[model samples]
Every structure is written in structure tokens, then in C-alpha cells.
Target: MTVGTIRPGGRTARVRAAVLEAAADALVEGGFDRLDLADVARRAGAGKTTVYRRWGTAAGLVADLLADMAEQSSPRTDLGSLLEDLRANARLVQRTLTDPRQGALFRAVIVAAAGDARAAEALHRFYAVRIAEWSSCVDDAVARGELPGGTDGAEVIRAVSAPLYYRLMISKEPIDEAAADRAAEAATAAARAGVFVRSAGAVE
Candidate 1:
């Protein structure tokens, strides 16, 4: 079903939900390269034609799945302090990346993004949405005089998750609450020191 054909809480929506869930399961179990439209349709109990008509390719399905994931992601926490808000963001990322199925699914998508241009665009958009969602914490902190003016809210939010992702994707180390706390603390310290402040006359 096309987007124009989809109505709220209708069969199209149900099919989309099922297909996206099945796509996530397939990615978690076998990675993106093994994601087949027919297999996903079978798993979702939808018609193969419907799946193909709605999402033409594996990349298309993955892109739609990423969009859905972004929409379903948790909202930012507001604890009246930059450090506490950052800690909440860090812990959320750490928890997601540490889960067995979710970790594998994210790794699969990251790997796919590395090799496919369309998937890469979708993955970047996913992070952009998430960062924008949490950036308000830094904005709120600045208003409260906790962080300096002109601090890059998006960059500060990214800093909170960067180390956790590094461990999950590169260092292959343990990603625990301690690691999350350390990331949050480091980002908070850096933000307090103006490390993420916007440069003057640099076009941001």
C-alpha cells in the first residue's frame, strides 16, 4: 500500500507495523544482506505483492523501519540539570545498545549503512532525529545558566552518546551503567568548559 492509500489505524497501517517488525527481526537474526522481501512478508503474514508494492527493496524497508524507530524513540528527560539530563540520555543509549536483540539489530543496520548509500542516509537521519530530540536539554540548561550561551545543543547531545557507541561499535568493551555515567560526566564537563560552544562567524 502506498502512503496515500494508508489510513490511520487501517489495514495499511497494520501491514506496515507487521512488516517493519518482521524486518527488524530479520536484521537482528541474519543481518541486512539476508533480508528478503518474500521472507519478510511471510514473517509478517502479509501478501508478498503488498510488501513489494509498499516497500520496493530491502533498503526501502530498512529506511521505513528507521523512520518508525525514530518516531517511537523515547522523549528527552528534563531533570533541571545538564549532567542529569545527559546521564539519562547516555543510559538510554547504553541500555539500547546492550540489549541482545536490539544491539544486533543496530549493528546490522550500521553495517548496512556503511555499504549502502540509501541505508546510510536513513541511518544518519535516525541519529539526527534522536539528537534533535535530546538537544532541548542543553537549551534548557543554558536558559538556567548551567551551560554557557551559544553551546551547541546537538553536539553536546552527540557527545553524550559518542563514547557509548564507540564501545559498542569499535572498542568492543563492556557498555554498562558505569560507562554511560562516565560518558555523561565527560560531556557535561566539556560543555561546562565551552568545548561545544559555537564558533563566531563560522556559519555553524
Candidate 2:
């Protein structure tokens, strides 16, 4: 089997896994601007025609890649407390952004989203899926009377991650454990203070 090929017993599945792995490698090595379908196919050891036929365009390939990532991402951690859950989420984000390969891949995808509408939409969807998954922890917190009755779980989750992303993408600061802990702490404090509560007339 080729690098990144999985023995899932299906040729199509193996091909897709290989292609997505190759795409990730290419993105890490050469940002989104240099992502070429033919090169990715070559690296994946898949036929160029097959890649083109399946993905159609670079944007399409990226969209699929994001989908795969969202599918494979870790499930939310339920630690019985909102603070602990937020901390877990923050640490996970920190670890991913601090990893050499994952950090590069995320940076490439983010850059791609800036110039490609499809990529942007895919990126948004990926985060939405993640947020939805983790938002359950916030819901649990509200049920436990740790937060306001109408606290926006998704918004709370986003608040825990936004600072970390800013450090990774904009401020160019270190996304270290300390930063992650601080983010979680701040978000938890805000949520406990009802900052994340939805207004009475707000859309659900």
C-alpha cells in the first residue's frame, strides 16, 4: 500500500484516503497557492484523471478535505463542569495549532478560504460542525445552573477558541498551553457572568 493508504477493504475509500493525505502534505509543504491537482494525484499515486473526475477543482478537493477532517476530529470532552470542558476544548485547539504539520495545514486552508468562496464556505461548515459538537457541554452547564438559561452554547464554544485562532493566524503569538488555559478561563468567566446569554428577541 502507498503512503497514507488505508486497508478499509474498498478501493475507492483507499484512493480517497490517499488523495486527502497527499493533499494535506502538499498544503503543509506549499501553502494553498501552490496546490495543484495533478501534483496531488501524482503524490497520492492516483490517476490524474481519477482525481480530476472526482474532485473537479482545487476548491472542491479542499471542501472534501475539510469534510474528512471534521468527520475524523475528536469528539467533545464532557468533564462535568463547564470550565473543565472549555479548558479541554482550548487545549485541543492549542495542541493542533502547535503541531508542525497540522499548524501548516490549517494555515494553508485559512489562506485558501480568504481567496476562494467554496473554501470559505467549507471552512465555515467545518467549524460549525465542531462548535455544535462541543456546544453540548455548554448546554449541560446551563442545565446544571452554571450559566444563564438562554446561554448560547455555540457562542460560548466559539469564544473559547477565537483567541487561540487569533494567536495562530493574526497576532503570530505562541498558541501555548498558557494561552489555551487563559482563553478557557476568560470564556468560562464570561459565560458564568451571562455574557453569552441570548437576548429575548434573538433568533435561535
Writing each residue's lDDT as its tens digit, candidate 1 over 16-37 gives 8888988989998999999999
**Most accurate candidate by lDDT:** 2
Superposing all C-alpha atoms, what RMSD in Å does each candidate have to the true structure?
A: 3.7, 2.3
Which residue runs does candidate 2 get wrong by more than 4 Å?
1-9
- Over 122-143, each residue of candidate 2 has an lDDT whose tens digit, in order, gives 9999999999999999999999
Q: Residue 164, candidate 1: how far off, in angstroms?
A: 0.7
Q: TM-score per candidate, in order?
A: 0.95, 0.96
Give me the displacement of residue 69 in model 2, in angstroms. Answer: 0.3
lDDT of candidate model 1 versus the reference: 0.90
